[model samples]
Structures are given as structure tokens and as C-alpha cells.
Target: MPHNTIRTARCAALVGPYLAGKTTLLESLLFAAGAISRKGSVRDGNSVGDSAPEAKARKMSTEVNAASFEYLGERWSILDCPGSVELACESQNALMAADLAVVVAEAAPDKAVLLAPLFKFLDDRRIPHILFINKIDTLGDQSVRAVVSAYQEVSTRKLVLRAVPMREKGVVTGLVDLVSERAWRFNPHKPSNPVSLPDALKTDESEARQALLESIADFDDALLEKLLEDMAPDSDAVYDSLAQELANDQIVPVFFGSAENDNGVRRLLKALRHEGPEVAVTAARVDAPAQGAVAVQIVKTQIGSHAGKLSLARVWRGEVADGMILGGERVSGVFRLFGHEQTKIPTATAGDLVALGRLDKAATGDRLTDANGGKGNLGAPADWPERPAPVYGLALHAENRNDDVKLSSAIQKLTEEDPSLVLEQASDTGELVLWGQGDIHLRIAMDRLRGKFNVAVKGQAPQIPYQESIRKGTSHHARYKRQTGGHGQFADIQIDIRPLPRGSGIQFEDAVVGGSVPRQYIGSVEAGIRDAAARGPLGFPVVDFAVTLTGGQFHPVDSSDMAFKTAARQAIAEALPACEPVLLEPLLTVTIAVPSAFTPKIQRLVSGRRGQLMGFDARPGWPGWDEVKASLPQADMQDLIVELRSLSLGVGTYVWEFDRLQEAVGRAADRAVEIRREVLAAQ
Candidate 1:
């Protein structure tokens, strides 16, 4: 092995769109590295990356899975990330610690757009990555060139195709290495068998090789000069230039493979082993000093049923050892993880990703440097992307009343595992609401709550924050008299109520001209009126109104604050209905973001949802995207993201805040009242 290939730890991340075969690629890589004697299939629920119970049940990854092994004396750790957009945060955190990323994608050209967001993230962070087009054998009708072209449309980096598939009667049976100028036939369970260049593929292969050279030469002036001078560069020079440019994130090398059959697995491993940057280089890239006190950054956190809390961290400087202190907590243990299993290790050096047991204070994306013989500094870089806003929510309550107390702590742990989820106590509705990226994201969270945390919850769509306000004003006189025995209660009051402008919350004042009502009892009467305002005849909290206490009579011998409070309550109950109460629904000023090409569709979407369009313009800082501002009823926003994404190829999103409350009249108001009645009845 070369000196650069000396035994050193490096991390790679596997990420892409849902069902892009990232898990399968991880298996193939492990098998090729001799870490696994037999590759387990996802269909069998035995793949190393998706070993969690939740993942097995859904046949998808629910969190980041770490697997480490040694190949040819070099240590390697690969993080298999969830492919669903709902779980993109997991992939992003893992990517921060990666020396390189292998973005696995489908071979079809039309589906290439699915990689846009991932590509943008890598490009923005200047994270070195390679595109591995998996399942090439399944590409019966698609041309590699067409797929490459489509990918290039979204990718900011120059793409260099490293190899061309060698087809036999329209079937991809092998591929020709462009740099080596050699051809090989794929062997299902072993390294590809070398073959002579086929006569029919000669022209296509030569053209593809030339294109690869040109793409790489664009970043290498010496190679560009050599190419312009019509002088061929040696394969060593070409490989050297390729590695250099890739380390700098100037270009993305494209490799094709069929992970299911293990073809191309060995070649990909060789490339990663030889070309991936070293730990020292990664430290320099992130501006972290190459030598310093031990520093570790937690990329993922998992609370295993038996293992307790584990913080998966990447050592950026120095070494981490069991019993070392991090973030004011002792590192209880250190272990190397492979799927669900782990091997206890006493120490981990720089560039090594190991799980530190019982780092309860640690969280994903937190950086901890050695401090006073313990870990410290729990901050991520300022440039890290903010968490995505929630687009869906559910009102959840424990199925069993006894689990109510446990539910909050269970959900806290759940959100800890996946920070994309949010939990809130909706003050308007008094219901516990769980917010997430989509229905799937919330479903998985609920599953964990029940299966792992033992808290079963019943869930439903969140209630809209509907309100009610009076349209007119009225005055009422009320009396409370009770003569059951000694000190019989006697009180009388007159109050005036009136409507205020929209969004003006309930107000109370005393307009009394004399002490017909004692000043101390006046406060008690106002309290009664405000309490009455809590519920309107329309079955919601009343707002945008005021109540004035004009006059009241109280018998000094027989009257108490309770008696006056009851009289005031009766006054409000009778006065509000005659004031013509109207229901008010929350209106959100939503800014819908979508590709410019879908602006017309978004306009139609807004209109169809009973929304008023404020206008639209190009989205700031996002190329080829538009932001359509509109005011929509909160009821209409429940499924708006779903519809918008459907129309925008799953790239659309929006941000919204409560703009105002608009009066709801006619059948809409009646329907809302009926729904509220039904929900209360069910509760």
C-alpha cells in the first residue's frame, strides 16, 4: 500500500432520495471491504443500515445508521442516512463529519431532479462528493449521457464521467474504465473480469473518454494546456489531477454500478480509499486546528433500548477515550458501531467516528472540545442550515389516561431522536399538538412513542384557532338575590358591552358615576365579565370587544363579591347574543415558494383554496424560484404544502404566520360550529 493509504480512519456518507438504493450500496461497500461475509438484503429486513425496529417495520431508514470496518489496514466508517426528505436533517448532520459523500441515485434520467436539494447542500458547503448511478442494469431504455445531462442541469459542480457502460445487445453487461483504457465484464460475486475492448463500443467509449478528460482539464491549467497542444497526458497524471480537484470540491466524478449484484463495488472502494481526503486535510478544510485538545462533534444521537443514550461523534482533534469528560459529563463508554452491534474500544483518534455512551447533554450537530479534562463547547458552525419549518400537525392525546404524564417525556425523547419533529401545547385549543414535516414523519414518530417509549396516543388533525366577536352592543341589568338563611346574598348590576375593531382582544372598564358599587367589588364584576367572554355562543373564545360596568347596587349587610360576580355573569350571558356575535377564523399571510415554472400553478392553487393573492416575485437568493404571497384561512393551510409539492415536483414549500382574524359568515361559519361541537363531544 502507498504511504497515503496507511492505516487511517475516514468517514463517508451515503445519501439520496427515497428508494435510491443507498442502503443496498452500503451493504455492497461493506461486503467488498471484507467486513461482512454475506450481504444482507433490505427485503429481508436484515441490512446493516436499516436494522432498527422502526426501519424494519416501514422498510425504510428512520435515522442515521453507522457502520465501521477495516479494509487493507485502513479504518473506514460509513454513515447510511435516511432518504426521505422528512429525514434530511439526519443526513445533513452526518455529512458534517464526513470526509467524502457518495450520493447514490437512480439511473433513469427523468428522476435526476430528485437529487437537486442534496446537490445544492453539498455545493453550498463545498463538501467533496461523488455521484454513484446505481442499478445501471435496470436502465434498459435510458442513455447514460441523457442521465448525466439531466443531473448536470441541477448540479453546480462540473460532472466527470469516469467510465462508460459496455452494452451487449442493449444490455449493460460491463463497463470500460476511461482512465485505464481497459474493458471488463461484471462478475456477480467477485471483482470484474478483464476483457478486451469490444469493436462495436470503440467509438462511443472514445468519445466519452474525451469528454471526461475535458471536464477535468477545465480545473487543471496544465492538463488544459496539454490537451490544447494535442499531447496526451499519462494515466497517473490524470488520476492525480482528478483526486486534487475532487478534494477541493471543484468537480464530481460519476461512477455507475448495480449494488444488488455487487458489480462495481470493488472499483468504487478502491477509488474512495485512494482519493478520499485524510483527517488532517478535513480538519484544515473546516478551519479546525490539526493539533489541539481533543475535540469531538456529535453528528447523531440514539437512545437504544438497552444501551441508553449514545452520542455518535467525530473526533476532529486529538483523541477521545472512555472515562474522558465531555460537556461536563463523563464519557461512560466508547464503541465502534456496525449496524445494531458495537465493539467496545478504549480510545478513538482524530477522524474516527465512535459512539460515546451516556453523553446525555450532547445533541446532534454539537461540537465538544476537551475542557478541564471534560468535553465542552456545544455549538455548531454558524453556516449550518436552520431546521425546516413544520408543514403538518396533529392534536394528540394519550389513549390511556394513565399514560398522560408519561407522554410528554416520551415525546421529548422522540423529538430528541429526530429534531425535525416539534411538540407544542396549543394555547388556543388546549390540545397537545405534534408538528412534523408531513404525515409520514409524524406517523413514524408516533410509532416510536408507542413501541419504544410505551406511550400510546390517539391523534387527529389540529383544530383551527377560531374565535368569535360581537358585532353590536347592548346594556343589561341583572340581580342576584338568595334568602336561604342568615346573611342572605343580594346584589344588582348594570353593564354595557360593545364591539371593537378586529384583533382587539377583550377589554373591561368601569364607567360608574358614584359608589353604588364598592370599588373593591367593581373588580370582581369585571372579572366575571371577562370570564364570561372566554366562551361565546359560537363555541369559541370571543375577542375584539369590550365591557363597561356602569352601575350596580349592593346591600352592605347581605352582599358579597360572589353575589355581585354572579349578577355580572348573568348580564354578559344575556347581553352578548343580542350584540350579534360572529365567528372569526384565523388568516395566515403565507409566502408560498416554488420553482418559477410553477408560478401559474401556484396562483391557481391559492385561488382554489379561497386565498387572496398579495402578489409574487422572484425568490430572494434562490435561483429560478418564486415567492407567492397570499392570505389564506388557517383551515385552508392544513394540506396546502401537500398540494403545492404535488404541483412543483416535490420542491415547493411555504412560511406563514397569523396575519389577522376575518369574520366567517354563512355556511362556512355554521360548518365550523358544527365541527367544533363534534370535536368537543368526541373528547
Candidate 2:
């Protein structure tokens, strides 16, 4: 094959904290690669990466945007992922398809802690990544080295500075490449111009370069020997070592620039071109088959207005052509995306990220293959990051009755695009609940529902699941007599009611003797008792009680199943209130996981929410973290995640399950009963 036709294809993902300029960096990369003539601005809502209406309105990326371009004879696909912590799932999914990742970061050292989870995720997956310190122009009076050191503290891997800032009068105007020994000054809207090294900064540059060399030498015995011998290594050899070490996940190379002004972007691209692994290496790393067989993994799914359902997938193996049979479905179209715009393509090969149309059955993270549908392993490592627990939830309902019919379908599409968003139908409350990482996350989902799917919904706090049970026992006699046109209905029964132990559930027994009531009518009586148990006197499901049928009378002709059932229901309804009914609140064993620094705050938070702290200990496998075990009322957990994040810089998380049902007491219990009474009255 000719060199022009035989192109090298690779992909990289951009990820970082909120407002870290990841989208801007993507725009800069596109401009530098000549894919776009002018760079688009996030502030102006013209950036290609954030083309969705919700993203443009909020000025933040809500989903992953994939774009492919050619630079210097090489084909590249860049996945620009959302930076918001709530949207981090988008980044996680996109990372599985990339050969490398470019982690963008803010220049402030104090905010370096925000990158803790992201760094841990990268390190845990052993995914090779490099750091891009963005917005360097805003680092007023802050030392870049200090920022680098702060980042190093969070990252488990060694952080190697690839360049040193060229500061003149305490302002960084350029950078000196440590490997190539070249200096370049930033030129806004144009490529950085090469400049001679300044004599004033020679000593600092040399020290920074020496530190970089030492960090690399730690992983290479030959490089260490050369360094110990006081020998200068060749520039090509140094670059090769850096690339090799980075690809091996042994060191993280750091670069700095302002993506808004397009500074240092070309240099970043050059580094990627030289160091990033090819598709073949990535395929092997994930254990994908070497032979070129049709295999694709759907990374994302979106329902387009004009194009219909589009599944964004990375072709992991053989060529995927339009109308090809894949996983029992025919591909409708193959499109290569340029931000929001897509161009129809005849075929896509290995390492190409393209959108396949009309694959309604294909969901995000689905591994698809040819008609055989064999050996499509998604290429995700065993420990791929799981979706974060929902920190916020809202009970949602359609604003218009007509939309209610379409609500479920719309939500399905929304979750199909973002697996992070969870939709639940509350079993007790019967409310449609939408759970997500935060308010912003849910808001974006709602926007997508309304804007894209034309579903407008009303949202409110989710309802707590509260139950009612009897505290005491009572016995009563009841009779049901009705006169009809021909046959009169008559039934009588005597029953004993008692409270059982918590979690024992409802129990029914027939202690009748001598056929006081026929065996057949006894079943009707039991059924009636159970039907009435669905709602106790306190307007909630009743549990932990027992009912015994002691005796009953039935007229042979006048008595029917309905009469016996009515008598049994009437007996329980009259006796339950007199039995000292009490409200039963759900108790959950909550294990609060957070950094040790915020353990005390978490304790206070639990106490304030009427929770009992059982104990606390170091969280297993997570250093400097603690898990506080507490028994908390279900009512207090509605906003726990919101408060937890506010206290722990968004790193705190917890797991909880129903432990038992405990009797609610004090004014809280009284308030709950009163509110439930009002709700029942309204219904």
C-alpha cells in the first residue's frame, strides 16, 4: 500500500475537573491540526465539543464529543469529555476506547485535591496518561513548580515535568523544552516562535531538566548509568526513553499552556504523535483478537433529530461498512463526526471512532460483532471504574398529560446516552425518580428530555418510604349483614390481633373449631385481612402483626365469600387504631466513606440527622480514608450526599441498605404522622 493510503490511526481522551478548559483544549487541538480554520470559544457557545443545547446553555460539556482529524500524515480521534464530576461517567466510558489520555488541570496548586479521584482512576486502570496544566496565564503570583508538586502528591505515578516555564518579571511568557533544549515564546493565534535560551534563566532551566532526567532514569538502568557517568544522552534517545516510559505507565509527563490562546498546543500534539501508541498496541493491551474480524464496541448512543438513533463506537477490529450485519442488526449508516456535524462514510477500520446509525438495540458499553456476534469483549479491564452512586435525586412527573405517555421512552433514551443517570419508580411512593451525581447532572438530563425528546417534567424531592405497624394488640367482634332483593347476606366473626417482633412480617392463623365458619369462607377472610393490610390506619403499608380467626358464623344461603371478606376487613379496621398504632421508620446501615480529614465532619453530619454512630475504622484498600458505620433514618438520607460533598470537597461517598424498621419517636414521629394524614386526605 502507498504511504498516503496506509495511515496510522490512534485516539486520545481529554478529561479533568470542572472548568479545567478541556473543551477549549479540544478546540485548540482541532485548530492546530487544521481540522478547523478558527478556534471556537466555550464562552460564546460556539465550541464544537459542546454543541448540545444544554451544554451551550450551561457553558459546560454534558456528554462526550468525538472528532477525528488528520495531522502530519497521521489520523487522530479525540474524545472531548465533560469535566464536571457528575459527568465523569462520560469520560470513563470514552477512556476505554482511547490509546492514551490527556488529563487537563487548573494551574492552582490549592485545587489540586480535586484531581484525586481522577488520578486514582487512571492509576488503578494502568492507563497511560499525561497532564496538561491549563490556564497558565491565570497563575498570578503562584509558582508553577509548587503546582506541579501539589499534583504529584495526588498522583500515584511519578510526575515528570517535560518543560520549564520562561518567566520574565514573574510572568510566564514562554517555555524551554527540556528534552530538545529549545526555547519558544507564545504567539497568540499563531504557532509559538522558537527563541534563544535566556541567560538569566539558564540555571533554573538546567535544574528542571536535570530533575526530569533523574525521574526518567529511575525506570531505565541504561539511562541511570549514563546519568551517573556524567554523560549527555542524545536528544533522540531521551525522547525515546520518555515515550517508552509514558507508554508503560511508569511516568506522567506534564506540560503547561493556555488553551484559550492556542499556546503550547502544537507542542502537545507533537508529543502525542511521537509517544502515543497505535491501534494495534491498544488492541493487544485489551486482549482483542489479532485477526481482523468485525468487532465494535459502542461507547455512546444518541438519538438525533435528522439521523435517528446513532451509536458512537470504536471499530476494534475489521472494517465496518454501511449496511453490514452486526450483532443481528443491519447498520443503517456509518458516519465520522466533526463535533456535532457528521459526514457519511462508506467504511471505518480498526481504531476509527465512528457513529453507526439506526442501532436501536445497541446501548452504551455494548460490544458488537459480525453476524456471528462472537468474541466482542468491549476491551475494558476487569476493574473499569463503576458509576458513582447517585448523590442527588428528584421525583419527576410529566408536565403535560400527553407527555406522560412518552415519558418512559424519553427517559430510556436519556439513560442510554448517559449510563450515570438512573431512573427508578419508587415502589412505595409510586413516583418516577431520577437519580444522578448532582443537581447539574439531573438538570442536563431534564434539558435533554425536553429539548431533544420533547418531554417536559415537574421535579421535586423524592418521597421517603415510611411504614406503619401496630405497637399493641386488641380483639374484636364484627358482623356484616345486608339485605338485597332476594337473598340477604350475613356473616359474623371474632378475631384476635397482636403485634409480632420487628421484621417478622404479617401472620394469619385460623383457630376456629367445629366449623364455626366453613373452610372455604376461611380463605376469603384471610384474603380480606391481607387486602386491608395494604394500608394501615396511618396511611401506610402495615407490617409486623398477626391476626387469628377465633370463630365466625355464616348463613348457608345468605352468606357468600363477599360477606365473610367484608366482616374480616371491618374487624381489622376497627381494632387496628385501638391497638396503639405506631409509625415505623426505615433504618439503614450506612457506611460513610471519606478521607480521614473529614471524618469528624461526617460524624457531626450523621448526629445532626438523628443517626447513631456504631463505629468507625480505616476504609479497606483506601489509604487515609475512613468508613463510619451509622444507623440513620431513611428521611435524613434524602440530601445526605449533597451535604457530604459540600463538606469533603466532593470525594465523600457512602453505601447503605435497609437494616431494620425502628419505631419513630418524639416530635419527628408526630410530624411524620401528621404529614401522612394530610397526604391521605388529599388523595
Candidate 3:
């Protein structure tokens, strides 16, 4: 029976690892809802989610995409999030606004490990999710139970299988709903056809139904009592328990489907319509206001060259009207987004995820309220997903120097859309470095630079910020006596140089007596020595050394700041070569979080990269995972994330910070110095 009346909109975020068929499932879901005439394929570059040129070029989602549809008189807005691990934060932002989440996964048992991070995040947040084992047609005689059991290892929430597969010889032909115990055969691109239960599956279905009942009974005392008394609980009672437990995020319902063929999509939609939590439940979960106060949380922001600033937000309470004053910024337009198409709406209420036009001051994760007392009132939740730390960086240069201003503006807009991107001007390297989660992430940004912003740019590995320090030091006396004109330059200085402890930095002092050097000229001598330290004999910043002026002579007529400064620099220049200056590279204290099974591989990878292992322990609050701490050289840490993900099934991640500097004394040091010299020559 279909609902006869229209209802309010609900939002769901489709999330999973890369290649999990989320985009394909989006197409099928829209087709089943009669929102689209035909399904678009991701490979064909025609899918609604692949509207961006960057996404189409790679045939993968580069960012969060929004789609809306109506089914059975109930409207829905689906947030189609990127699946790559590098873009996990993008999914987190969208999930914060959704009423529920559909965790799509491939039906491969070995790939279950890939869900650990996402499962931990969802479980930690108590977000209600359904595990949909997609591409079941590719199961290849493997039972869905195996896949479910594999996933159960990673998820803390109880997983309740909703259906049991029915196979013909070795191939799955249909499935039986555990609650209804009704068999239905799949019809491609259409509704499943009901069929009588096969005799062979009767016992299987009975066992599965009992399991489902028992799982839900754990949360319902009445159901538990009925089961204990050998009484068969009604299907309605089972469904009610399932809905209640799911709303409370106590369990994860499991379903299987081949979304590419449009099989089982209707059942998923029906389940959502019947079991999904209301906007009130989500509002309470996120601590949204209880009253009719207008508030919206900006989950994602998209800045278009033509569309201008579009803030995709969820209306958590009250109604937001076009031209309403929110946080002192007038909402220019209220739009319901469908990929690239935006339909102008007069208003949006709670649970509606729409794009607001021209809220320039608004940013992602801002909760805008109607508290406009002439001052903006945008509150950000503490649980707002922290932007992932940059694990990769590239020195970005405009292909045409004339486009430098445009490049920076475009990059700023890109950062607004994806907060994970970080732009920095390196003090040591003097390069405009852009930091991100990985190379692919930075590549996507570069693509958008050329494709979306029409700004030409190029990228390369950023230069390492390496410093040079002295192991030994000696003193030298320098004299600047240039008799070029009537005013001849004449200054002499005797300085004692000695290496201080590491991290002591470059220091300068004077111990001259008898006022041999004028008081004003002493400051110039110190400045010149500091300036000389900026570019040492090794062509890098010098550190952990000190210089003291023992005695000096000067001609008052010509010995100005410039003469003293020149003589001080000359003294240091002559003293540095004999001081045994050594190359020093920065080391980072890295803490890597990964499944325990990959800890050994991580250790080996670190060891291969000149990393010294500190220790490893179970990750706090995350079961079955380990946090491995190590000290790695900054030069070797560049591609560590890339290799770590390759070794850990794409789930390994780490945080790193500068710990200290270490002396380099091998071929690696020589190679680094060689590269530095070459780079300097080029410049």
C-alpha cells in the first residue's frame, strides 16, 4: 500500500569506502523513486553525482554531491559523499546533517577491514546506520552471512541481517525477508515478483527469522518474554522493536543488493520510509534547538564561478524563508539542489537540506541562527569534524606569473569548499605550498584550479625545511679598510665563535672593553652576524652557535653601521668554513593509527624510511586498532601516507609534528645537499 498523502522531507547520507557503488546506487534509488527517467552510469560519465568535470575525468566522486527525490509521497534528500579515504572528512561533514546513514559496502569478505575507521567514527557518534552489502550478484557462491560476519568484527553495534539469500544450484536467484518470511525473485529495473517459498529455504528462513527476532528481542522485554515462553511474537512487534532500537542507534540492520541492476532498491526505500527516524530525533541527537527558532547548520559549501556562493545547509529548526536575516546575512535564495540543477524554493523547514545563495560570511560547519542583533550569531558544534591534518604537500606555482592573484583567489575558494586543504608560505623554502590528505587530494585541487577556475598552475614536492648547525667553531678577525674617497671605511673586530647546545639557536654578544668599538656600531656588528647566519656556508640557516666581540677598532669619520656590519659579516664568513658545519634535518613525531594486523607492516615501512620506532599500543576508544608512534625524518615522511595506505587496506592514517632536528651524515645527507645546491642554482 502506498502513502496517499505527502510528508516532510528526510535526509540520508550514502557513505562507504572507494569503489563501493554508492554513485551507482544513487542512480538506482532515483530511478526507483520515479525521479529520473533512466539510470545514469558512473563509467559513462553521465551520472548525476558526476556532474563536476573533475569527477567525470576520473569517474570518481571528488566531493559531496546532493540529490533530491520523492517516493510514496515522502520527499528525501540524499547526500552522495566521496568514498576515497583521503576525502573521509567530506563524508563526516555530510553525515552530521543527515537523519540516518546508509553504509554501502562491497560484498567481499576480505575488504571488511576497510570499514574499521568509518565504523569507529559512526559508532563513536552514535549515528544510526544500515549496512547494505552491495553488488551481491558478484558474491560468487559466497554466502551473505560470511560478509555480515566479517563486518561484525569491525562494528561495535549489533548487526541484524534482514534477509536470507535463496540460491538456484550455485547462483543467488532471490531472497526471503526474515521478518515476513516471504520469498521474492528479482526483476531487473523493476519491482521484485512475489513467489512461493521454496521448500529448501523453509528451514533456512525459519532459522534466520528466529535470529532476527532474538536480536531485536534483546531491546524489547515483551518480545524477550514471548520468546522465553515459546510464544511467537507478531511481525508488527518485531518491526516496532527494530525501529526503536535502530532509532536509538543500538543496532545496525543489514541488507544485500546489486544496485547496478536496480534489485532490492525498493525494499531499501520502503524500509527507510517505515523505519527511518524523524527530524526531531536527529535534532535532539545533534543538540539542535527544541523551539521554533530558525537555525541551519552549514554542512558543505560550494562556490561556483557562475552560481556564486552556495552553502548547503540543513534546516534544523523552524522555517527559513528567502530574504530572512540569518546571522545578519540576508539569505538571497533558497534552493533545492539536484546535482548541478538548483530549483528556487520560497522556504525550507527542519530536516530540509538545501543550498542557500550568497551567504558570503557563512562557512562549512557553522550553525546559523536568527539571533541577528546586528551581530552575527553562528555557533559551531564541538563535534564538528576536525579538518584532517595534511599528510601531503605540494609547492604550487602559477604557470603564468600574471595569474598569481587569480590563482590565490581561486585557491581560497577551493579551501572554502573543502576545509581539508591548507595553504602555507614556507618561511624556510619560500614556496607557496598547498597541503592536503594525499597526492590524489592535491591533484583534484589542481584539476579544479585549471578546470573550474580556469587558472593554470603546476605542482611539485615542496622543499624540506632543513637547517644547518655548527659542530665546532673558531674565531677570526676581519678588517674593512676601503680607501675609495675622502671618507675611507675602516673597522676591525675580533670575535670568538663557539657552538652552543642544539636548539640554542644563533646568539651574538659583545665583551669589548675600553670602548674600542662605539656603542652604536656594536648593534650593527650583531645585526650583520645574524644576517650572515641566515645563509651559512652550507647555504642554509645556521643554528646553535654564538659569537662574541672581544675587541675592535674603528675610525669615527668613516666607521658607520655599514662598515661595522660589513666587517662583522666578513668575520663570520671566514669563520664558518672552519667550524665544521653539519646538515640538520627536521624530525617529526608521528603517531600512526591502523588495524593491529598491519602494525608490523607499518613498523617495517617506517624502518625502511629512516624512522625510529618509539612504541605501539591499542588506539584509545577504538577496539582492535593500534597507535604506532615513531620519529621520522621530514624528508622521508613526504610519501609515508601513500605507502601506509597501500599496506593497510587503505585505512592507515597518522598525525605528525616537528619534534627536533637530527644531524645527517650519510649518502642521504649528501643527496639532500646536492639537491639543495641544484635548487639554489636554478633559482
Q: Best candidate per lDDT, number?
A: 3
Q: Model 2, 22-141: lDDT tens per residue?
A: 999999999999989988899999988999899989999988999999888788899999987778888988888888999999899977778887888777777789999999998888
Ranking by TM-score: 3, 1, 2
**TM-score comparison, 1 vs 3, better candidate:** 3
- Whose TM-score is greatest here? 3
- Across residues 167-195, which tens digit of lDDT does each residue of candidate 3 receive? 88787778899888889999889999999
In candidate 1, residue 630 scores what lDDT?
Answer: 96
Candidate 1 residue-wise lDDT, 1-683, digit = tens: 43245468999999998899999999999999889999998889999989988899999998899999888988999999999877888899889899989999888887766787889899888899999999999989678888888898879899889898988778888889999989989999788999999998899998998998899999899999999998999999999998999899999999998999998878889889888888788777876632238888788888865569988988888888898777678899999999989889888988889999998888877778777556466577665567888888988999999999999988888888777888999998888999988877888888888888888898999989899998899888999999987899888998888899986798888888779999889878987887887778877888998888889898989988888888878788888889899999999999988768789998799989889999999987666678999999998888787898789777788888988999998777899999988877796
Deviation from native of the Cα of residue 154 in model 3, angstroms: 0.1
Q: What local lDDT does model 2 show for residue 563?
A: 92
Runs with alpha carbons beyond 4 Å of true place in candidate 2:
1-6, 290-292, 371-384
RMSD (Cα, Å) of model 2: 2.1
Clashes of each: 4, 0, 0
lDDT of the candidates, in the order given: 0.87, 0.87, 0.89
Candidate 2, residue 62: CA error in Å? 0.6
Task: For model 1, state the Cα shift of residue 454 in Å.
Answer: 1.2
lDDT of 2: 0.87
Alpha-carbon lDDT of model 3:
0.89
